[model samples]
Target: MRLTRHTDYALRILLQAAVEPERRLSIAEVAEAQGIARNHAMKLVNELAGAGLLATVRGRGGGFALGRPAGEIGIGEVVRLTEPDLRPADCENCALSPGCGLTPMLSGAVRAFLAELDRFTLADAAKGTRVPLLIPT
Candidate 1:
């Protein structure tokens, strides 16, 4: 199952913010640091701001930052808010919803995916040793 670009960028934003709670960041900063497209990062940043995940500031000495505490945000919630729905493909949502055994299996897998996501929070992403944050300190 492939995640939407929005969801992927949202994760990037949150993880970027988590790395450095000492200051506010901007979509530009995140895009440059994460090596993602600036336009895409800006879109994700706006969506995250709307979702109350990050706060934005204007002007020279301003940027963006995490809206709430890191530990208070859940990975699953981010996915849910940004993704809207998680289907392996649109074909899964076709008229086959009535009696498709594959649907049930995929449904179960989705549940499992969400359950796993629920197990982690922003803190997990921030402190993760595998993919460290790229904050400017």
Candidate 2:
């Protein structure tokens, strides 16, 4: 199943943060690095912060960083937080919905997909990635 842009952006944000565990990154920095809009990055960062996946600071020299260790953050958990709908198919409007087995099959597929993601952490995803020099303003 194709994941939404929201989920994609969220993962990108996490990976960027994971790349620099010691440095706090601003939304603009992440947006520039990920090629996403600043507002979008801000929204996702706020959401991630709210969920305790990211930690945010305010005022001068304020920015964000991973809330916990990279190894402690599960990729699947991030996906679940960002992906509102995981259904692979829309069997609800189908005439054969009542008798269709596609729904359960798709559900199982989604489960399997998430389960696989659960096996990896942000650290796994950020391995060998070069950390850019971003001086927070």
Candidate 3:
């Protein structure tokens, strides 16, 4: 299963935030660091904040930070939240829908993949070490 760019950015964003729990990062800062577009970063940041992964503060001196502790943020949960759809295929409209076992098999594979991701958290991604965040302080 391939993750969307959105999910990739979400993980990158979370990792960056987790690396510096005390610092608030702006979308521009993150975009520059990750080599992503500012608008894309902004959209992902807003969605992440809405989903409770990150906290956003407005106005001067306001920026983004992880909403919860790194250890508490599950990678799988983030993937599930960020991914638009997890279906392996549109079996409902497939020509072989009548007798296809592929859909069920594919769904099982997706479930297993997600279950594997559930084993790790943002803290795991951060490796429990304080790394220099992509966002400049």
Candidate 4:
């Protein structure tokens, strides 16, 4: 199954923040860097902050930064929080819901995917591309 755009954006935001742990990034900057809409970035930042993955500072010279250490936040945990539902298929209202085995198979696949993600954390994800972004902090 494919991840939603919202989750994709959320991950991007987390990665940027994690890469620069000392600097708080504004939504506008994140939006510009990720080529996403400002409003969308704003919403996702709020969600991330609410989920405790990001910490926000209000007023002038304020923005968002990682709330917890990148190594402490698992990729799987982020996926779980960003994704509203993990169901592989919509079987609740399907005519063949009772007999369809596709649901279970898909569910198993999703579970496996998440389990694999659990092995990695934001720190792991950042290590590959963060060298250039590091601010020496």
The number of the candidate with the highest TM-score is: 2
- lDDT per residue for candidate 4 within 1-137, as digits (tens), equals 78889889899999999888878888877788777899999999999899999999998888999999999999999999999988877889899989997888888898899999999999999996643333221
Of the pair 1 and 2, which is ahead by TM-score?
A: 2
RMSD of each: 2.7, 1.3, 1.9, 2.9
Provide the overall lDDT of each model, using Cα atoms, as 2-decimal numbers. 0.82, 0.90, 0.88, 0.87
lDDT of 2: 0.90
Measured by TM-score, how close is model 4 to the native structure? Answer: 0.90
Over the stretch 18-134, how does candidate 2's per-residue lDDT look in tens digits? 988778899988788778999999999999999999999997789999999999999999999999888877788889899987788888999999999999999999998775566
**Better model by TM-score, 2 or 3?**
2
User: In model 3, what are the clashing residue pairs, if there are any?
Assistant: none
lDDT of 1 by residue, 10-41 (tens): 89778878877788886676788777899989
Ranking 1 against 4 by lDDT, winner:
4
lDDT of 3 by residue, 1-137 (tens): 88998899889889989988878998888888888899999999999999899999998888999999999999999999999998878888999988987988988999999999999999999985553446454
TM-score of each: 0.84, 0.93, 0.91, 0.90
Q: Which candidate number would show the highest lDDT if scored against the true structure? A: 2
Error of 2 at 23 (Å): 1.2
